[model samples]
Target: MNTPARSRITAVLPAHNEVGALPATIASLRAQTIPPDRIIVVSDRSTDHTVEIAEAFGVEAMETVDNAARKAGALNQALEILEPEGFVLIMDADTQIVPRFIERALQEFQDPDVGGVGAVFRADPPTGYLELCQYLEWARYAEQIERTGKTFVMSGTAALIRWQALKDVESRFGSIYDEQTITEDMRLTMTLRACGWQVRSPVECQSTTETMPNVPTLWRQRRRWYLGALQNITEMGWNRVTRRYIGQQVMLALSVILMTTLIGLTVASYAVNGFLGVQPFWLVIGAVFAAERVVTVWDQPWPRRLFAALVIPELIYALILQSAYVGAVWQKLNSSQGEWAHLGTPHKTTEEV
Candidate 1:
């Protein structure tokens, strides 16, 4: 019997003022069961000690002058400098990979048809109340990924991509990471599929990442995400008649629109009932929806499950922000370009783990 060959993996970390998160992230990479051949951390105009921290880890640290395209631009800048030879694993500075994350992710690419693979992501443990709420939401995402091999989007926290597949798409689409789009991960995955490649989420690979730990931060983060989703749909041109990718994009857009509209209508009904002395059925409906969400995640542990049960409040918040973002996206689809506000910055600066 012959043993299988090992895969060559290169990990890329795109950093911008991530001094505090850099140490833990680097340590996580160092602690990998099957270590990467090379770890590259691209410092995108950091005003902090991000590059210094990366160098301290004995990893390759490269600094770039421009921070124009945000995370996607940072990633593409890294790609430009690094030679394209093997699998590229792109991760955020705040994300910590599990011991076997890379080892397992590489295994999926052994199947040539798989162009990219996403890992099961969980929020870092011992988080705050709001963070726990975010964790439960991610848990639902993890469940869906496990059930369906097809993932609608690949998380930037931890994703493995075949170099050849990336090159193929980049050659046609101009750049693997689109600087114009806010949700580069979704855009790249969609582009890959458009060019005849399959993207999957593997069950084995897992990564732990930080989540917004407060209501205000979570609101801003989700709003930007919703806005980005709208931009991606328009940029890709949501056409059900032409391609399945377009159809999928359209469905995703409509779902967002529908959910936002439903939430807005429910809220409006509650206000109207209070003003006109009408029945408060909408409030009752909202309560029922909240109860249903709580019931769905009842199997989790005490506090965790309790937190999950209170998802309605979070959902309501998300819907309101998403509705506003959708309107903003509609108005600025042609020229909406901005840096994603770093929500975990406070935690990153204060917390040490």
Candidate 2:
């Protein structure tokens, strides 16, 4: 068992109509090995039973009348009312933590220089095939976090950020409450780095959260994410270049663009070959890529992992979605608009607390 230290820890959950999942998420928090000094839930214009549910859990709840700014605004509002001397754990109401997650994260912040830390996030299980594919994608992400202490972005689902770090640039980095763009995580990460802080993911801190379960939901999520990335790249281009932080962003952007082009070309080539009554070399290339994905997913079970390994289909879908998102991003950039379209509702699930 981990002993609670003298250091005060505040857990903040920015919620919006999260009544269905908040109960389990709060239960997991109550079961934490190191109980938080304060548990605050920021209710963002929730028309549901969110406020009542949070009261039932006995957590301090504050409602925001003007939720025009979305999550960042909700979080900042909570921050304004909380004691800022200790660490702040920013979590989503849809996620549940392992017993040791907060304890482990607190220990990591003891390093002093660490500004923020993220956890190993697993998408909720017993989902459909598409959801399983998302889980595999998250698994790969977790591996990357373990391999490199530096993560390009931190998931809001389970992130422990220093209060001082947040306060330093919270006001300078634009309106925190405005719901513009889907890439708030990336912007926050960049802001921290700009303030001379490092963010990391400790392997022991684990959290499970739901993922989009179907192609349509997945497409919308990815599109918003891509759009956010593009907006961030444009807004902070100079900061990124001067700080030498654009390398990874550029590489990822290029990779997505290249993948999209390759897939489109391959499809066009196959169609032309069919018309000309000849075999296409593009088919051979596609087969080789598919084989690589299959080999990559080989460590897992037969059909599920194999289905997850289908690189071509996934890449093609990503390209189409990202292309449309990029267009939306460009529109926002040109018009100087900084708000995101709410993608209806997010899928929710729970794991053992």
Candidate 3:
């Protein structure tokens, strides 16, 4: 009996001014249990030592510039140099993957019909209260993917792309990641599905990436994400699944409006009548939520369970985060769609993971 030959896998990281975060990313790639056949670091006009770090790791280091499409352009530049065959694992320069991440993601390729695989990311030992909130949210999302076997986009944070599926996208759109769309990951996933490729994110296929460090940074990051999602939704034009996703966003928007209106009216009533009303309802909602999360945080330590039971932190986080979607709607309506800066990276960053 002979063992099966594993597919050739190439990992590409599009980096811009990622000198501080690139080392661990490189190390993790090197440490993959079923390591990539080659690792390419596309240095996108970075002022820092991104290229040097890649060279130091002895992987292929290529510099690129004049990429109006930014990350996708950098990636295409690499594609032009190398023959597009085998599986391509796209990763962020700041992300670190678990030792078996590549091996697990590649296993999904056992079914040739599976075009892409997205990783389940937990904030890498998150720092700060804001990051903890994000970590919790990520866990819930990962749980959803685990349960449903589906996701909106193959996360650009860490994703494996079947070369043939990518070619299908490129032949139609002339690029793997559409440069016109702001949220390239979502756009690529939609494109893949439209081309009859099955896409999924296995909850067990894990990676670790830094979460947004502060409220302002998170707001900026998600604002771009939401705005890009809106743009892609519009451009997709009647994609049934995309429409359903949009409808969900619309409901979320309405909920926010209704909540704000109720809060405002309550304040006015309190001032006029010298009585507090609706306060108990708010307290109950928080209490119910805290209890739900605490119960859901299975196998987690007591300290984390207690943190999960504190609804205030997550509540504040949601209020601000959800508002980013509204701001994105405004940007979409006004045609003021901004560039994809990518997880608070300083300059141009756009690509399909």
Clash count, one per candidate: 0, 4, 0
Off by over 4 Å in 3: 1-5, 278-286, 340-353
Q: Quick one: ranking by TM-score, best first?
A: 3, 2, 1
Instruction: TM-score each candidate.
Output: 0.82, 0.83, 0.90
- Report the C-alpha lDDT of model 1 over 1-353, residue by residue, as the tens digit: 11135756899998777787888888888889888889999888777788888888798999876557777788888888777777888988878888888777767766777788877788876456566666777777777677666587877778988888889888998988998887788788788887777777776777887776566666656656656666777677755312554564466568787886765876887798764343589668767877766665565677766655566656664565555556556546556553466544654542111
Residue-wise C-alpha lDDT for candidate 2, range 260-291, written one tens digit per residue: 78668768877987643335786688688777
- What ranking emerges by lDDT with the best candidate at the front? 3, 1, 2
Please provide, for model 3 over 261-289, each residue's C-alpha lDDT reduced to its tens digit, 9 standing for 90 to 100.
Answer: 86799899999999985578878877887
Assess the local accuracy of residue 112 in candidate 2 as a C-alpha lDDT between 0 and 100: 67
Residue 316 accuracy (lDDT) in model 2: 57
Displacement of the residue 108 alpha carbon in candidate 1, Å:
1.3
Model 1: residues >4 Å from true position, as ranges? 1-4, 126-129, 239-299, 310-312, 330-335, 344-353
Each prediction's whole-model lDDT (CA): 0.73, 0.70, 0.78
Model 1 compared with the native: what TM-score? 0.82
